[model samples]
Target: MVASVEEVSSSLVREYLSRKGLKRTIACMDEEHPRTEASINNRSQLRETLHIEDLYRKNKVDKSPFKTLLEIIVKHHIEQFVSLEPNDTKADEITSAVVCGKQSKIRPETEEECPSQPSYRSLMCEQDGLSSHDHIASANDSDCQKSQPLIPFLENNVSFGQRKPDINTMKPEDTQRSRSNRIRRGMMAGPVPQESTKKRQSRRAEVSQPLLSKEEENKQAQERLLFTGIHKKNLERSLTGISIADCGGGKPSGRVQSENSNGKVEQNMQKTRNVKTEPNLSDLNVSELVLDDIDDDDLREFSKVSLQRTVAKCQYTGRPMDKQTATELKAVLLGSSLNYFSVEWRNQSFTFSEIPELSYGIVQRKGGPCGVLASIQAFVLKKLLFENTEISYTGLQRLRPSNATRRQCLVLAMAEILWRAGEEKQATVAIKSGKSHFTPSDHFRSEEVLEKIMCFTVDNLKDLQFILEQHIEQFDSGMLGCILLTISAVLSRSVEKVREDMDVPSTTLIGAHGYCTQELVNLLLCGRAASNVFDNDMELDSGNGNMMLLKGIKSHCDVGLLSLFEHYNICKVGAYLKTPSYPIWVVCSESHFSVLFGLQRELLTNEDKGLEFDLYYYDGLANQQEEIRLTISIGNLSQSFQEVDTDLIPPLELCIRTRWKDAFVSWNDTEPLL
Candidate 1:
């Protein structure tokens, strides 16, 4: 065996404390506490006593390891006189150090003659309940030899690793084994009883407390039952003879055993006293008693073994998977998209039938600067091509680009449109190159050029107002939010007409860019521009043109004609409800554009009632869905991606709604929108 071992590291102690949520105790360890400081300084004492090094490598303490470690350390301090075979010199040294501070003994006549350190006395008093006076008496008393301190046998001098005795002693091997068994059983004896003649006389003189009457006992039992919420009878039965013995086999000092003058009781007591010196192996029933019974002496040895076995079985044998669990686990393991045979159970037998796999129509990605339009096309294509109950991650994966950086979403959308246009090679080329065949100027009535033509300038605002006045057929129209939608539809139709005149079979795509949306609305209402040429570059997809367009439109629009609602400030929904002329609302959030159409059945002058109307939302880039109902309330609109009702709609419609919700959506009305 090694003479020295490493102490338990501070890291292990920290991890143990953290797992137990006792971080506050670590705060004290850092502070100045004498016992802790002494323990830190006296590393050798702790190392020798608890064998702290082995605590981590082999944690033998089954319950409350920290508590067991503390008990071991405390027991080591008190083991000098409490040993089964005491060495006189060691006992004297412990007594002298504790009571007289290196002096041999403390005189009874002059008790105050010997001084002791306050820290040492306080530490001892805190660790054990023994006062300095009690320590001196315990050290000097002859009864100490018979009555030892209440510490577990394992914590004393006897180590589990001690070498076994030679077999050729005085007895045969069988006899030696029996004698060793008797000694082990004797060591499992209950706590030492009072033995002094003077103590016995004092005990006889002391009055014993009277036992509770039957009625009072019943009342107390009922109170306990009420407190624990257990039934009255069950509580009473459990309390009758419930003896919670320590796992160490030591009997609790306060436990009361019934008086037994039987031969068995006498024989057992006699055996405990004499067995340590000269064990009688024949008397003790080693076969009947289990070795594990030494840890818990209260329960029958056989029952404890059965209990341990039952617990071990429960820990090892987990519940078997049922039909539902098996099906779900199988679905998850092999991708959910993979087909599996459905098993139906009838009576004792089950029939398995193969479920056919679903096929998907491949939608290609189109090229050029139509990513937004491509996304919308992909969304529509998915819904039109596939038949599914709800929007699935697998279905959406086909349309969306896996890589976010430099996405060819527009190319995919263009490909889908060109595929519909019957130009498969061009579509393939568009997807591969990720570039548009038609330049910014090639398409005549193309919606792509609408933003370039409707250049938002102070000079253009008057033309925008003129254009709007002409297009908004009825003043104070119920179709206020439909302005953007109407412009998009009109532009789309005009582009299709031009494509028809040119004999171009492919349908020209339209996208709802934030910058172009406001200006397009202006151009559609203001009438045709003199020329498509603009002050700014025609290719203004990624720029500050949208912001400038918004500013220019806001400046020219009639008072109360337009209102803005930030998705984040949705709590200010009340302000938008009261706009005169049923304002054309534009919810400018993130980089997306959405129109709020006032859907009031009848005109109302009252602001309170006016605010209660439903607002129809038009998001051209809204995936597969056509329109959204933005129902306004006092504080919020009824909307959430999770709460969205996509049940009746196609998978593509649901995908669009999901994408919208994923973008600039608010979780709670009180919190800001994402």
Candidate 2:
């Protein structure tokens, strides 16, 4: 052979090494590298050839341990995934760098220009990030000619459901008032009176369609949710109890399937390691039965869009509570909760009944949303205590819980809360709604269209919710910020007190810090968080204004307890929060919140010395076939042995004491399940 390319290159390198008198370098080169050739000379091309750009990106922002492995896996998949793609000469190189199912979503438009460097997103990756890379599930490259984005790729194969994006995208808006693509479906106030009949007619004509017949629709819903077989029977037998669902035309509640969905709107119910389901609004809202709370007709049907509904069951009976009955009980409970636990004892003995008058549903222990769930419990209690929303209709009050509107309700409530919490800048930003109350799509679009702001009054509820969700999506801080917002809506504590007691310093958006604090829980239930102690409800901030808010456990709201840890301090949770009026308690473990409840109202009001009741558990995770069941005893139990402080007790036993002074919990020979 004349002279191969490698020989010639090696000879040239040897000559150069001899000229520089680097014999050691020449020897090292000869020993280390048998071949060196560059088909592509530029840095970009070389980086592509090596396929180690992800490694460089990892070095730029990585602080966590698993990020190293993540980068490697992503690199391998990207290389394998990209190579099999069909040639697309017309497509522009994807300008946006996206890591799907991550804390940080796509980078802002500014970061698109820096392709050589990985500048967007934080190092944080979910523990399940590996499984989420559905692009790798393929046996061959030909399987992945479908799409490039990881999220969309997963959405293609394993669809949980149609859920609102957890990570809310943020962008700047020029105007405070939103006018285009807006409709005012007043949730709290019911429907806003039309400013002009002519306009309402025009819009209704454009979007109007025939309403689904209730009988036929519910029939379809039943078949879809349950099968007429032994599985359905088993499911029914295992149900722990009932929950108060919205009075939405008596439709049954259903759980989300992890596989593909059969409905138009799919609710993505993801189960965490702890089995807490990330909430996508449990079919219906916990709207009070109070018909007077809003205009009945307006609340009945404000929007043309029909969303899926979850059934509500009785906490005590495990039977489906009718809409009318649930509404009545909810109204009564709402009336009682407004008292804020300020009730005079009548020596009332709780009369136990098989008929579950008090309905309760179990929402799963979604880890990131405990704070929000806690606040929502308090918020509903607060509304019942204060707002005049009790159901007056004798007949089944047909309505939509309007989860979308409920989000609006929460956002508005949060805006007020943020203001009270001394987050003025964020509150200000959150309160600015476009001219119209409803912006179905392109909620934050920059382009403005001049149209009638029919109802001139601004509703910051929708806008505030978007901001909070966006922030939650941005930092993946979970529901702590949402909890603060909900707490602000119902909490009676003064702004000054809240500012002083808040664990995280005030900012535009409140920080969740990933879990619930004693202070935050206090604020959620007792309308105050003056102390961190989870002991007895006591007098706090006696001085003046809202500052004199109640903290700690209230005298009578005890409904028993369930905690994951056996050694948890029962005194760490305040009385009212541990035992809520909804006949439900949030079972918190590892920062996740599941629900524990009883069907009887007497759990809170029964003053009998030897009180006993059955308690049921529900976690929206839908992992279990039915709700878990347990039993509780109070004031009358004889201990097998005298227990000391150092001697650990089951969390269920000790936590009940937090509510009842001398209570005993019984598993009834059943194994303890937290």
Candidate 3:
């Protein structure tokens, strides 16, 4: 095999052996070579290099602990801390030399040298005994500096005195004539001479022109000085009682009175001057000086006097205490706030009336979708289009369904209309597609669709209502969806059919924007005596909500035989009901609504009747048919509740039944329904 190692001199091998404290290896070799002093020194250096190479190859080289650390730090600092300017080629050379552990010959150009550096010429001088390499570097540096000049220190080049000129100074022509000039010119007399229009216009133009030339400027300055001087001189002359022509050129005099004149005697002179020579006081404009000594009482008296006078300026035909006009004015003032009563009087006695005329009135307002329905019923239903609309008109009364069966007839008619309008199918698609407003086909015009549906109207509206109620129980009828349903019912069925279905004479299609509860209640009283008057009238002597609920209940009860209470308060079950209204009552909880019918009326009226109530609840959305028996004796009734002869039974305490639990209720809990 070929030897992998290089041969060492015998002397070097001997030195290595001596350093290792081993026996001299040269004694074992043949002593044929002569050793001179020069040869020994050469052999010693060879031994040192050989030993170093061996140690390095064997991975046993001795080194400072900080040497490798220092080299790594220097390389990192060169790459990280050094910032290279744009096109700084010298920076690249320096970085490369440092990284390679070689000296960098690249020197910064003279111009590029730090401002704090020593002489610039010495850095590039070839006469400094530098070699050819240094000369070449200097030449390259000069070329670089010539190509890229040093940047000036911008921070030290701040300007000190220069400033922007003002706008007024730059354009003196834009300056407006001073206010004093106008006052001074106003003193000039008019109608002195009538020059030709052309000459007058030319003079005006010259006057209005800007003061541009130096001569014009000097002229204006002199005029200003003359104005001040003449005004002072004229003012002094006026104090001396000189004539106007004697002072300045028969110019008009100013209104400024001379302070040097007598305290009271000047007034006599002023009157004579105005009458004989001066113009009218109006033209002179002394209005600002004409003041009256008016204190607070004087102002009051003036206002009183003005108010006492009416359309005609003539005095009232009566004395102050008995003036009919004054009485009339007082009455008008009181009538303006007739709707609002004074509440500031302490210890004031309030009158109580058995009738509801003095009771706190509740103005009915229709709100939300319910309001929309009410508006259509109260306004749209009475139009000529629906004037003749009734059950008889629909040709459904021929079947002779009893009054009890009218609701069934109306429901059937509504269902037939929906079926004809194709809303049922559209609604199903909307539900499946998870969209609320999508109506699938536009095959029929809205009115035509309604008319067609009416043609197919079912005779029994109640049965259809029940089915719809059941369907809605399991589904969410969006607000719009529910409103549309009500609208379709009105369009397809006659007013009589709707009346029967809703158990109220007036059926409404209400919504969030259109109608309110007050309007809805008013609509429910349609065809009744109460319906003719405004729902807000205190003279009507009935609470709007109670009146509406009573009117609806009267349609289903035998209340026509009894006298209408005519005067009633709100939230009272029997306030307007003269007969037994226990058979049906509308219940509302929040936005959800239901109707309750008494299942055991005779039991309720029994002399031994307990505090229990048996009601049949009909929820439109839930389609629930529940017999809710609740104890209402624990619920408190108002102390003011009265048992009138017209009332059928004691007022039923309002209560809410959620699931199977019963709780007392407030009329405020429900909105439009209440």
Candidate 4:
């Protein structure tokens, strides 16, 4: 039973050793050992023991301290098994030669005859001469034997295979020197040097060596091909997935049901990471891909065309502007420093010549060309043509009867046109032919257009005033009176300085031919005239004429002249006549007599009348001699009318009184009393 147990345990150990691939040779056991009991339980216990031993071996190999030893043993076994394959003897010999040369130490030759039969070790030493400090010092010396090229027979095939040499294979100092040499070479080659012929040869030699065996190459090639094919398919699949994503695959799961209802979108996402996507350039439309190329001139032309079209549309529609059009027009008008063109339908022309002048006050008052006025005129003409049915072309022609009449007719026509155009002032001026001196119907054989003229004149106060003052004779007395009253009212309301400057009273009598009866009284009473009337006319009789003039003046004097004097606040009248010694008697009109009487009464009535008063009348009957009349009055009344002595009067007073009496008599009998 013990032997059976031993056999079973040995069987188990053999099986374990075979499975673990370990070399095993069992040792013969001693035969004098006691026999062990063998029951079913013991056999089971042996099995259990064997299992435990196997577990212990595995633990020692896989974990901790013994694992390194296990790996070394495994590696040794693999190397031995692999080395059983046949290899080339020539290759082996060459490899041994190279290794032997690398390990050998050879001394440098002396300066005599070179050493015969140079050893492979000497060749290796020469090839690796950079290791010596002396070789570095003699680097520039071409004559040095150490400078000779080494490995002349070996092809320039120094290949750096993927299975690089382990650092442990070389001495640490040698490895450091090799790295320094590599760094020095790199430094010598600057950034962009041409590849030397030696480098090309080395690269060719490296590629020529078959680092990968045929089987391995084939296997790797197949793998690469498969990977490439899979990659392409994956790329296509990813592209399809991208398209799906674009078409709602990336939407909430609730929005889209998947075709394969695995309920695990996360898995699909994981698969997606393994794929690549390529953009489909062909899918883009040609038109969408190409952008239009525009030039500066083209853009400018487009803008011009668009503006012109918009303007044309606006003109054609005749509808009130919508917000957009109005806004555009406003922007254009404000933004641009140019005038826009407008069509004059009546004129049948397009022009920018009539842009409105943005200004205040009377149109054309300044001497510049009147753009606003011209525009208004053109507008009026258009309105006339369209609205006034009675004004045909022939009628229009009749309206302008002659070249001289043309201005008047045109003004009338303009006025009418303006009236129709809703310009009341201009329209009224147009219809009043006489008022504007237009005589519109007179040119066409129409009757005295007085009513229309008056209407026009009345409507335009400024024009009427201008006409009345400028062409005074053209207006009737009634019209002139009306104009004067209007002017007076205007003056009263106007600036005081202007009224004073104009001197309305003087202006009113500016062109009067002669002083009328009433004007004479006003002049005297209001103190508006210069003193002493003198005339050069000497032909007329003075006695009756002078007496008649005095009576006429007395009759005209009434309370009106006195009231005028009071209103003007005339304190006193400077004496033109004085009294004393001589009585200068003269014949004169009754008007002159009346004037003298009034003067005598005023002087005598004054309590402060310091100077005595006298009147003299002269009739220019003789050429040299003068006739004079004098009267003296005192107190508030002239009680005693007596002739003063000639010698008593001052000479100047006598001369003045005599001359005035003669002048008054001559003026009274004139053709028309002024």
Best by lDDT: 2
Question: Each model's TM-score?
Answer: 0.17, 0.30, 0.21, 0.12
Compared with the true structure, all predictions reach lDDT values of: 0.29, 0.37, 0.30, 0.29
Which tens-of-lDDT digit does each residue in 197-261 have in candidate 1?
54443343242424756565455434433422323222222223222333257443332222233
lDDT of 3 at 141: 35
lDDT digits (tens) for residues 350-452 of candidate 4:
1111111110011121211122223222222323323335334432232111111222222332333223222133212211233223232322322222222
Q: After superposition, how far is residue 428 of candidate 2 from its true place, in Å?
A: 8.9
In candidate 4, where is summed lDDT lowest over 10 consecutive residues?
353-362
Error of 2 at 106 (Å): 66
> Backbone collision count in every prediction?
13, 35, 34, 46
Ranking by TM-score: 2, 3, 1, 4
Number of the predicted model whose TM-score against the real structure is largest: 2
Candidate 2 lDDT by residue in tens digits, 113-161? 3222222121121222222222222111232322223454334442344
* RMSD of each predicted structure: 30.3, 28.8, 40.2, 53.7
Residue 177 lDDT in candidate 2: 19
